[model samples]
Target: MGRMMLKNWLALLTAVFIGLSLAVISIVPPSPQGLDTPDDQFSSARAMVDVRMIAAAPHPTGSEENAKVRTYLAGQLTALGMDVDISASTLPEKALARLNRWSGQSKTEQPIYNVIGVLPGADRTKPALLLMAHHDTVWASPGSADDTVGIASILEIVRAVNETGQPARDLIVLFTDGEEVGLSGARHFFSENPLRNKVGAVINFEARGGGGTANLFQTSEGNGDAARLFARAVRQPSGNSAATYIYRILPNDTDLTPALKGDYAAYNIANIGKAEYYHSPKIDADALSESTVQHMGSQGLDLTRALLSADGFPRKKPDATFFDLFGLWTVIYAPVWGWAFLGVTLLCYILPLRRDMLRKDTLVGAVKMVGFMVIGGVVLFGLNALSGGGSGADYYDRLAAIPRLEAVAGLTIFAVFFGTFGRSQLSENGVLGATLPLFILAVAGQSIAPTATYFISLTVLLCAIATFIRRSKQTETYGQWISAAVAAILIGYMVSFGHLLMLGVGPDLPSVAILPAALAVLAILPLWRGLPKRVVTVASIASLGLAIAIALWIRLDPIASTVPLY
Candidate 1:
């Protein structure tokens, strides 16, 4: 969009975005009980160990491993004097019989066992708090971090409270199975073994990644008594300053949310349920790989740290207004990046394609440069198998390791620039002929596919085009444009792969500055004689680039600890 249209769009979107953001903000489940010092009964951080050890009692999932865990928990809970139940998904004869017995009764079917331990409380009529932690881990990796942590936490808490002779309501410790594969254990338990009315609440301990700050929220959407409990159960100022309480409701639900929300959202659907936390930690078994977070890190936060961290945390906005305002900017400007790209392409197409507009030196240089680039492409192909795809950070690692790349790249760039700086008789065929390499790269299929080599070749070809334009421009000597071109590519490196190198994402790179710097260098004709050509040709590209970078930076970094957000 042009300046006028962009201005209008931003203004309109800002208003709508703010309004919707406010609406979303209001829907999160509010902690009703409010933050209370855990010293009153429960502690700030509790570990569930014994019941976890007990719940590891029977391996109903049929795997010898899961059975071992089940056997461990059952023995532990039985020792605690609570009733124990077992179910298995192992396609075992007994588990099959159990499933066959209940076939027509409910839609949910999973072999699971329930281990319950009761700790008598002060008031018998008071609702019993259901303490829960899943005993299951993913299929491969040890669930130690994903939830051995959670299970152990629950068991320890129950042990402490029970041993202390605490007075209050009863505590029903639940060691759930099949939590890794699905909420199979919990679902079947709830369906088959409905709780008594005295069961007032449930506390599920789930882990995301490495343990840092634990985010708490109600499984039910909208509002409920559970919301109040969360508000109260959460201690203030929290343990980790870096910790973020993602206690706001998003627009969707996870596995556990459906059952809870179905019962809970029944209370306040009109309010359009919201939440601050859901199970979002990445466990190894959930098909997560280092590459999963690494690749997605391109489009998201430090999910690895978020999931795995036990000490660091997600910080909440000091005021809700910040999120509202920032979310508005994101909603409004997200599309503008694509629009900016399209507008530039259209302008490029519309502008008069004039061969005469090119300088004499530029034409000659283009020819030589294109020739060298063709040679480079063939060489790149010949050496193809040496490099792998996925464009992993490994390339950067190896590139940095090689001192030759910097020296060779620098020398080659200069040589090409000097070689193409000038030539007198520039025929149409010769000039058009020079673009063959560039045409191939620009028009090729997406890179990073089976055609990665082709993509690399294309990138080299584009570099040639940059050289052609750089050589043809008479404003500054080829040296200046060449340096700028090199710098532009460096700047591109920072943008395309910059986030990875930053250590991790946060504000530092203005993003805007990168493009303007690169463009000022590449668009050398702007400073030379062809003023109109520079404006329409060079400046057009430069200005458009600057505009895009600014819009994206604004959208991405609306609120900052560094710059004045306004």
Candidate 2:
């Protein structure tokens, strides 16, 4: 009984640690106290002033509100002790026709303005660091989160940088218009403007929702040098190569598109949560998450400061494999090194089995684990379809349903575990069997997409080591401690990974989170032996029932005014 009690306590302790990790990393930095009483510093409080003014009304391209925003932005830049230039162009005739047909308006032309401000460095010879943000909102939406936060962040970043000292190179701020209709403003600036030649690096801030962690999601091709700079410069960095690879395949568009075409290093960062408020009529000053604003500003300020002070911008190099360690520090290596990790995991699994002589029960357990994952994936796909997923569903509506969708997915996985593993006892050999499929999947992932598979391969390697230790004589206590530690790390990493996966592809591919979730659950299987069957069954049913009710609520909820009219 004492041994069983100790096992249960370990389970609880692991869960608490996982929760603590999530809570610490996911929080947006608090608004600085000096914001309102600004004294030559960049503060979200002061930035909020601009966000309020820009997002006070809908300011789509060609609208009077957009013109007002342009004039206001020009005035603000002028007050910042810089010469602000406004480049205005008419929308191409063909694009105007398309917009007319889409909006059912007979408008034949639309005007766009690109605002550029130059704060010359003490030395004028080096290439400039460019800061980019759009200034227009989607039609009928306040758009405080989408680009207003970005615009406000740039203004604040400049304010803070100026207060520190004159930069080593020219600091250019490009606030482009017509971003809502398309990337017209950014395209015009990067393609036609002479200032494009002066730029060596670019940092673009963006948003997809009203709140969530701000992810550094994209970097220039061959970003090894640039990523290293970022990892060293930014505190509490949140990024991974898997996100970069996925973004390459996604059809998403941002102002960074035209910049990427140029010979300049670049970064794209955005927050994606409370997504129902993205581009919605309800996106106002109060609707915006101040913490989200602070988060963006904090990251932008740090990177900008580092770049401005660097001896020279990072030159192009081979891309690096990088991931954050519990949001504390970034670990980077050459992509080719992923093979070493995969080899270690393979050896750990196979050598242990060889020593134990490959029992048949172990093989059976491996098969069952794979079967469990397959069934879980199928259940998630079906539930997602029922929860207004699939191609026919409105993109924004599906985004709004993410919270519910996450719950549904979680409950389904829990239920599957209860019905399958809760009733059965897995001998030591059976436990070894479960690792086989995970090991195979990790190997495949490492070979095909090393960056994406690190979470899988690394966790398996840790668990395999613990398993090996457990098989030793008179070292069972040591093994349990190591296992608990492994579980804690895996669980923490997976929590952040799951949230990011949902944010990046939640509307269409939430089921992908199951891969990490399953691995995390299996990692703690030893402690779970003490978990009661009745407890698992009841919790499973309750969670599933709640998930279904939430799904129904999502379906029944009317289209919020926050969603786009089109």
Candidate 3:
């Protein structure tokens, strides 16, 4: 009984460690400790001054509120010792047509204003780094997170840069209008304006929601040199090449679209948390996350400084393989190096089999584990369809249902894990077997999409090494503790990766999260001597019941006050 109790205690401790790991990775670093030295760097508090005024109302393009925003921006830029230029242009016919389609309006003409400010550098002829954000909000939403954060971040970046003295190259700030309408202001500026010729590179700030990790999502093709600069400059980066690849295929578009068409190096960054508040009427200045604001401003300032000081823009080279390590730092390299990681993990898994002497247990265990992955994935896909994620479900409504959807996903994934693995005890050989499916998947990913798969591949490699260590050690306690620590790190990274994935694609495809969650749980299987089937059953039932309760509550609870008024 005492031994059983000790095992239970260890299990509890392990659970706590995993929780702490997740929390640490998910937190947006708080706004820099104290602003006593505000003059030395970009300050979130100073930036909020602009966010408050700009996000005061729903300032849709061509509205009187938007006009007021334009006036305020011009004055602020002028105060920063910039030569401010405001140009108004009629929205293109295609953009006006889209506006009419989305709003059912019959307006024949729409006007958008573009704001430009220039900070002279020591050298006048050097290609300038263009900083961009759109000032207009959606029709009925304050849009504090949508583009206001971007605009405010740029304003603060400019203020902080001035305090550092002149840059080596010119810094041009572009606050675009009519972004929510259809990137009309950006299209006009990049297509018609003469300033486009002065730009060597571009840094565009944007937001999809009110809070969460600010990610450097998109970069121009041939981002090797550019990504290297970013990795060295940004102190805390929450980005990965996988996301960049995925974003290329997604239908989402931003003001960066028009700019990407030009011969310039471009980077697009955005925060996507508390996504239910996106374009919602409840998005006032107070709703904006101060941590998110700080994250965006700090990363932008760092990258801007780096670009301004460089001899010239990064020369175009092949895309680099990059991802952050536990949100602490970035790891970047050539895609070819992924094979080295894959080869090592393959050897790790293969080497263990020699000791077991081609036993039937290894093969059967591997096949069973593969079955588990397939069954779990299919079940999740089906449940997602039933949980307000069907083909005809309203997109915006699904956005509002995200919290409940997450609960459903959590419960369903746990239930699948219990149902599949509850009855069996995974021996040392069985742990090796479980990694086989992941290894196969990794090879495919490495061959087809190296960047997207490295997170999984590298994670599997670490876990496999932990497994090898567990197998070689005669003492069970040493194996448990050591393997547990490695598992914690692997799980921690996955939790953060999964959160970012959900934020990026949850409304449309939440089931995909099951892959990482299941793999991470399996990575720690060596510690589960035998989680009692009864315990697993009870936990699964309880989680499902709670998930059902949340789903019903979602049906009954009042629509979020933030939901768009329209």
Candidate 4:
């Protein structure tokens, strides 16, 4: 018995380690390329020179520093063999109001200068491809990550394109002013400039944090053709229809917001990591993540090259479902395929059922799984409240606490999982029963939101397969190992997905993590063997204590010194 317990512990530890390792690898951004990298490829070292220059100080609209950055950008574009100009326009009344509030002065001169450059292609008659980024900062922030990184990435992308030779169509570089102040420059240009009519497609770069993998978060309506192009062109892509779906419903806007009004193929890419550094006064070029710059620029270069070489812009088609596979490659397909996946999932679960399996145990398992989700969600909500969430919390301070909050959520979920199921010896039917709730959710999601339902459906399908394998080889030694392998894949994806969710909205909604946590539980259920009651209780208590301690730490810690003052 002692030897058997030791083996079980070892197996569990191995599976967990494998899953965590895969999760870490999936989320890490690519390594930064150096100056020695070929000129034809985008390099962060080349980009950082521009980042350091443009982000040297807060260059808000109408400031002398803003003019200096504008002049420098125009000169660089000219040097890259482009026809460059600075278009000066007055900010609208709404933008002027925001500028006045930020600067604390009512005296009104609302001028914004937008930098425009055109690299004439082999066929100038074809519509132009635009690459855009904002050149302005907020009041006190250096804005190294918020917009400076975006500007620098465009500069690097243009240089690489020049090295390759003229594109099949014109390439337009737009460095808009006053993005931090209501996207004033972009609004003026897209609505009034003659050049807007020339643009066929637009790729806008943006950021919310200092580091992390850049994601293609938003695209224009009917993005099937655009997404397919992106999947084929970007070698190390990171994005999903689910992210685009969520962003569409959120009250968020980037410079792309104004440009989307035009008849153009549009894509918005950004990174959301190191949340504490977003618009922070202390965010400087030296503190920025070079890997993030490389990730953004490399992907940008690939997509630009592909579009510049295509016969014409992608025509509007029904939106497709797509996501990257642990950053290795993208999986894209029509939303209609989701029904087929659901059908297969159902078959996998039903095919392995036996006449001898007890219906009573299956019902109990289903009830327990539902109870776990509800109880876990409540605990997460309570813990988030303790960590200074909900009404009256400082929004920026909560943003700074995202990493710690993610840890608290993860540990709390682990505690809840153990407390709920650690001592239960589930039969094969019981394991299948535990997955019923999530299966139902997947079905509803597929019916109502097919693009976003792939993750849930895929999770159910994988868990069902694991259960079938275990049930078929009940007396075989290698059967559990095979199940463990399947669990590792599912856990890795869930962990990475949960990390992203935390970065995106955990500051306000850590409780939303319950969905991913429940999916992960389905993977673990098939491999679980009941533990001693005392051991289970001790593990649960220890994990819960650690989670609470982290929550208290976040609550008591002072607001980050780097947070913007105004």
Q: Kindly provide the TM-score of model 3 when superposed on the true structure, using C-alpha atoms.
A: 0.94
Q: Write the per-residue lDDT of candidate 2 for residues 1-566, one digit (tens) a residue.
A: 68866775666487648754754565344444345645444577888889999999988777788889999999989988778999998777765665575468998678889888999998888999999999987777878988999999999889888887788889999998877777889988888999999999999999888987677889988888888988998775767888877787788889999999998889998877788888888888889888778778877888898888899888889877788776667888877787787777767666655566477878877876886788778877777777777877888877777777878877887777776676666667887788878888888888887766777778778887878787776677677777777777777777668877876686788778788777877677655563577887787788777767776777777865567765
Q: What is the TM-score of each candidate against the true structure?
A: 0.36, 0.94, 0.94, 0.97
Candidate 2: residue 157 Cα off by (Å): 0.4
Write one digit per residue (lDDT tens) for candidate 1, span 1-566: 46643543443344334433443332222221212424223221222223234233222243566767767767766665555656443333443444344333332444555456666655656556566667765433344444454455455445434554553566666777756544666666555565534444444555443322233322333222323322322322011100111222233322244245323211001010000001222222222222211111111111111111112111221111001111111111111232333334334322435665455644553555455454333322222222221234233222221222222222332232222322222333333334433343433422212111222232333334444443454532443344344334333432222112111111222222222222222222222221233334444344334433433333343222211111
Give the backbone clash total of model 4. Answer: 0
Question: Candidate 3: which pairs clash?
Answer: none
Candidate 4 lowest-lDDT run of ten? 470-479
Clash tally for model 1:
60
Question: Which stretches in model 4 have alpha-carbon errors above 4 Å?
Answer: 2-11, 473-477
What C-alpha lDDT does candidate 1 achieve relative to the native structure?
A: 0.35
Whose lDDT is higher: candidate 2's or candidate 4's?
4
Let me know the TM-score candidate 2 reaches against the reference structure. Answer: 0.94
Q: Stretches of candidate 1 above 4 Å error? A: 1-60, 78-83, 87-110, 217-219, 222-233, 236-255, 258-566
What's the distance in Å from true for residue 195, model 2? 0.7
Encode model 3's per-residue lDDT on 1-566: one tens digit a residue: 57854774586378548845664765555454235546758788888888899999888887889899999999999999998999889988887876676567889998789999999999989999999999988778988888999999999899889888989989999999889878999999999999999999999999987888788999998889999999999887878899988998888899999998988889999988888888888888898898888889888998999999999898788888998776678999998888998888877667656656457766766876776667656655665665656677656666777766777767776776676666666766777677777878888999998877887788678877777666574654465666777667767777777777777777677768877876677666766655677898897778767766666665566656667766
Query: What C-alpha lDDT values do all the predictions have?
Result: 0.35, 0.79, 0.80, 0.88
In terms of TM-score, the best-performing candidate is 4
Per-residue lDDT of 7 in model 4: 63
lDDT-better candidate, 1 vs 4: 4
